[model samples]
Target: MNIKKYILSFFLLISLSLFSQEVAEKRDAPKPEIKISYLDSIKKTFVRDDLASCVDSLWLKELTDLDLYNNLSQDIQTINFDEQVDYELPTEVLKARLQEMDEKSPFHIEYNPGLENIIKSFLKNRKRAFERLMAISEYYFPLFEEALDKQNVPLEIKYLAVVESALNPKAVSRVGATGLWQFMYQTGKQYGLKIDSYVDERSDPLKASEAAAQYMKNMYAIFGDWDLVLASYNSGPGNVAKAIRRSGGQQNYWNIRKNLPKETQGYVPAFLATMYIYEYHKEHGIKPERAPIKHFATDTVMIKKQISFKQISDLIDIPIAQLQILNPSFKLNIVPSYKDQAHYLRLPQDKMAVFTSNESKIYAYVDREANLREKPFQIVRPIVPQDSINTLQRLAQAKVRYYRVKRGDNLTTIAQKYDVAIEDLKKWNNIKGNKVAYGKNLRINGTDVEQKLSAVAKVEVDKKAVIKDSLGSKMDSFYVVQKGDNLSAIAKKFNISVADLQEWNKLTNNNIQLGASLQIAKNSIKEDVVAAPERKDIQYVVQKGDNLGNIAKKFGVSLDDLKQWNNLTTNSIALGSTLIVAKNEIAIVTNKAPVASFKKKEEYSAPATEYYVKKGDSLYSISKKYPGVTISDLKKWNNIKDEELKPGMKLKING
Candidate 1:
C-alpha cells in the first residue's frame, strides 16, 4: 500500500510538471502577424535560379519596414509601415472597394498578339525603370489610396499610374500627356491643376492623385462601369464613348478596346500586367531596388517671393538634386508663388529648423542674386519669363503699385516683374501695345477705381516716363521647337496656315530637320541687311605709313567696308598676308587705278599737301593727312555735320 501511494504521488508530480511546461510554452509563443500575399506564377516559373538562392528571390517575404521606408529616411521613424500593413481590412471594406472598382474601371483582360507584343517590347525596354517605379511607389501609393477612398473609387486603380508614367513624376509622353498620372494640359487645367512657370501641380503626387480620383469619379458617372471608366481614363471619355457607340453601346471595356487608339489598346493590358507584377513581385524575381529617397522625411514652408533651388542648395549646402527631388514643380529651378503668390518650399525634416532660421536670409539672397544655377530635371519654361509675374492685366487705382520698367523692358517683362500678366496689364492700361519702354513708370497694382482715376485725371506724378517709339510692329507669332518637332506643330503656333509656314520656309515636303531655322512670318521690322562690303579682288596690304582711310580710298571702297570684310571681330588688320577680299574669279580694278603701286611704295611722304572730301565723306578722312589731327579739330575749322563733308569739298590741311 505504501509503495503504491509513492508511485501515484510521483506520477501526479510528473503530470503537473508537464502541464506547467505546456502553460509556459503557450505563454511564450509569439502571436502571428497577419501579412497580405498574392501568388506570382510568372516570376516563379520564369526565374531559373537555384532553390538554395530562392530566399534571395523572396523579395516581398524579406521586405521590412526599413525596406519600404528606405526612400524616406527623414520621415522613416514617423511612418508606421508595419502598422499600415497590420491594419486589418474588414471584409465589408474590401467588398465595397472592389465592387466600386468593378463598377467603374476601364481595363479588360484580352489576348491580342499585337498588344501582347507591345507589352513585351515595353517590358523589355523598361525593365530597369522598374526600380524607379518602386522607389516612387512609396511616395505616390498612399496619396492615391486616400484619394480613391475619399472618392469611393477602387483602390486597385491606383496602379494606373504605373501604366501611365512608370511612376516617373516628370514623364512627358509623345501625346503631351505629362506627370505620373499623364494628364493632358487642358484636362489637367480642367481638373484644377496649376500648370505655370514655377509649378505644375499635375506632377505633384498628392495633387495629381486628387485630380485623378475626381476624374475617375467623373468617368464613372458616364460609363457606370469600372472597366469603361478605366478605358475612358486611358483613351479619354470621348474616345471611349465613341468606342462604346461603335460597339453598339456595349458596356464592356473589352468590346470597346478595338475602337480605342493604338496606345489605348495596350493601355488596359499594361495596367493589368503592372497590377500582376506588383502583386507577385516576389514570384517574378523582379525585386524592387529602392533608391534612397530623402524627401520622404520633409517639411514644407510657404515662400512669398520667387525662390530658386540653387538658393536653397547654397544656403544649406544641400545638393540641387536633393532639392529638385523634394520640389519637382519648380520649372527653371524657381518655385512660383502659391495661390497667395507664395511658393511652397520643401526641405528635409532635420533641415527644416535650419531652413526656417535662415528663411529671411534665404529669401533675401534669392531676391538679391538672380544668377542662381537651375536644377537639371526642372520644368522647361513654356512661356518667356515663366517664373516672373504674369502681366496679363493692368493696374487699377486702389490696387495699383508703382513699378519701374528697366532696360530690356516689355509688357511680358514688366508683368513678370510685378507678378501680373501682360494681358492683364493691357486690359488695365487699355494699351494695345506690349512694349514697355525703359525708365517707364508702370502702375503695377491697383483697383479698378484707381485705373479710372488715373485715366480721368491723367495723373503724371513725377516718375520716369516710358518712351514708346510707335515705330516698330509686333511679331506675328512664335513657336517652341520640341524634340521630334515637325512642321505641323510649328505652323500651329504662328496662326498662319501650315501650308504658308511650309511655303515661307521653302520646305518642299512635310520633312524638316530639328533645330533648322525656319521663317514663320515676314519680319515686321525692316532692318537693313547690310550686305557684307565687297572685298577687293586685288590684294593690298598696309605699308608702314598707310592707314585704313587712304587704303580704302585708293581701293575705291569705304573704310567701313574694309573693316567688315577681313573676318575681323575688331578694326585692326594684319600688315601682310592675303585676305579673302573677293572670290578668285572676280578681279576688282578701281575706276581710279590698281592699289599695287601705292602698296609698293615703302617710303612715306611726310604727309599729304592737302585733303579733299568726296560724297558721303567725313572730316575724319581729311584729318588722316596730319598725324594726331582728329575729326574734332577738323570739324572745329569747318561748318560741317560734325565731321560730315560733301564730295569735292576742300579741307585745310595741317600737315
Candidate 2:
C-alpha cells in the first residue's frame, strides 16, 4: 500500500494528523454528511455555457508543455496496428467468438480479417502492456462507469479512453487533443468543460468521462449507430457522413470502413481489441497488476479557500506527485476556490475527515507563508526524490556481490570467506555490532572499500547498527539527538549509563538542542543487534490513516523500539506531524512494483521482427518500442560494446 492508502486504512485504529496542534477541531468532530453521490453531483455542476466563450488569451498563456513523450495512445494513433502484431489463432475460432461478442455489444463486433489482425496484434505484442493497462484501468474504470452511466452512454464505451489516451489523464496528442478522452480545445470548450490558467477539465478523469459520454450521446443522435458514433467521434460526424455517402449510403460501419480516415479505421478496431483483451485476458494468461490505490479507496472535498498542492503536501505529508495524480485537472497546481462554484481536492477516502478538521490550519499556513514572503508568492518547491526509476538500478550499478545468510554464519565468517574486513561488512550492510541476522543478504567488503550502498528502502533502512567504541574507554560512536528525544532515551538506545552520557558531553542538565549531536560509547554494543538512524532525518508525519507497526517496519526499526523511543504507553503515536522514521531520512519508494508476470510473462513470447533505427533513436527507445526486447539483447545482437547509436542503425528484436 502507498502512504496515502496506508495512512487511510489506519483511521479506525487512530486519527494521526488531527491530533497535531495544526488541526483546529475536536477529536470526535462530526463528519459533514454527504447528501448525494459524486456521480449525481457532477451533473448539476457542469456549465451550460459554450466552452469557447469561456476561454480567453490568459487561458492560452498558461499552457504547459505537451506530456506526449512515451504515451501509449500517441504511439497507437501513428503506428499501423494491423502490421504491428501477429497471431495464429484459427479463423473459425475467432469468427465464432466475435459473433458471440457481437450479439451482446451495441457496437459492431462482427468478424473481419482487419479486426482479427488488431486483436491478435494486442495479444501477441501487448500482453504485458495490456496487463499493466488493466491494472491502471481499475482506478479509472469505476469512475468511467459511474460517469458514463450518468450520461446514458454504454458502459463498454469506457474502453474508448484506452484507445484515446490509454487511460492517462495527462495525455496530450500530437494534434493537440488532450486528457483521458482526448478532447480537442474547441470540442472540450463546446462540451462545457472549464479550461483556463488554473484549470483544465479536459484532464479531469471524472469530468472528461462525463463529457465523452455526452459527446457519444450527441454523435449517436446524428448517426443512430454506436459504431458510427465511435467512428464519428474519431474522424468527426462529417467525415463519417462522407464515408457513408461514399459507401452508397451504407449504415453498417464495416461497409463504410474503407471510406473513413486512416486513424479512424484503426481506432474502432483498437477499441474492440481492448474490450476483448480485458474480458478474455485470463484465457491468454494475462493478469492485472493492480494500481497503487483503488478508486473507491479515494474521496473528494470542496475547499472553502484557495489551496496549493504544496500546502496540502506539506501539511499532510503526502507526496506532491501523488496529489497531482489524484487531482490532475488543476493546471497551475492550485485548487482555486470560486465564490459561486465549488472546487474540491480529491484524496484518499480516509483523509476527508482529517482535511476538513484541519482546513483552517492549512489556510492559515498559506496566509503566514504569504505574509512572510517579502515579494510575490514564490515557488518553494520541495526537494522530492525522482522515485519513478526503480532501486534495482542502484543495486545493479553498485557493482556489488550478494550472499544469502546461512545458518550459524556470522558477519565475521562471511567477511573472512570474501577476504574482507569485519568492520567493512558491518558498514557495508549497515549492521550494528558483530551481530548479523539469519536469512538476510549481507554485503561483504574490505575496509579500503566505501560502505553505504545508497541506503535501503521503506521496507526498512538498517539504522540501529551499533558503532563500537574503537577508542575502548573513550566515546567513539555518535547519536545525533532527534526532536522529542531526552538524555534518558538516548542512553537507553545506546545501552550506556546516563551518567556516562552526561560526563562525555559535559552536560549538567538533560536539556539539549534539537540540532545537537552527542557521541555515544560502544560499551556492550557487541550484544546490540539493531541498526540506528543517521543525519538527513527522514521523518514521515503520520497522515490521517497510518499504522505504527507498518511505519516501524518501513523505517527498518522494531515496533517495540518505536514505542519505547516515543515514550508511548498506548498504541497511539501520531502525537506530532513528524513520523520520526529514522535518524537518516530515507527516500520515498512506491510500494507498487512493475508487473513482472501476468502469469509469468516469460511463459509467453511473440515472434520478433527486425527494425532500422530512425533519427533520435537509442537502444533504450528501441527496446521500449518492442515488448520483450531488452537493451542487453540489443547489445548482444549488434555486438556493440557501448550505448552509442546512430541513425540508420540496423537491429534485431526477439520477443
Taken over the whole model, the C-alpha lDDT of each candidate is 0.55, 0.66
Give lDDT tens digits, candidate 1, residues 197-290: 5578877777888999999999888778877777788777889878878999887777777788765665666666566446545543556766
lDDT of model 1 at position 338: 38
- Give the number of colliding residue pairs in candidate 1: 44
TM-score of each: 0.45, 0.47
- Model 2, C-alpha of 34: deviation from truth (Å): 43
lDDT of 1: 0.55
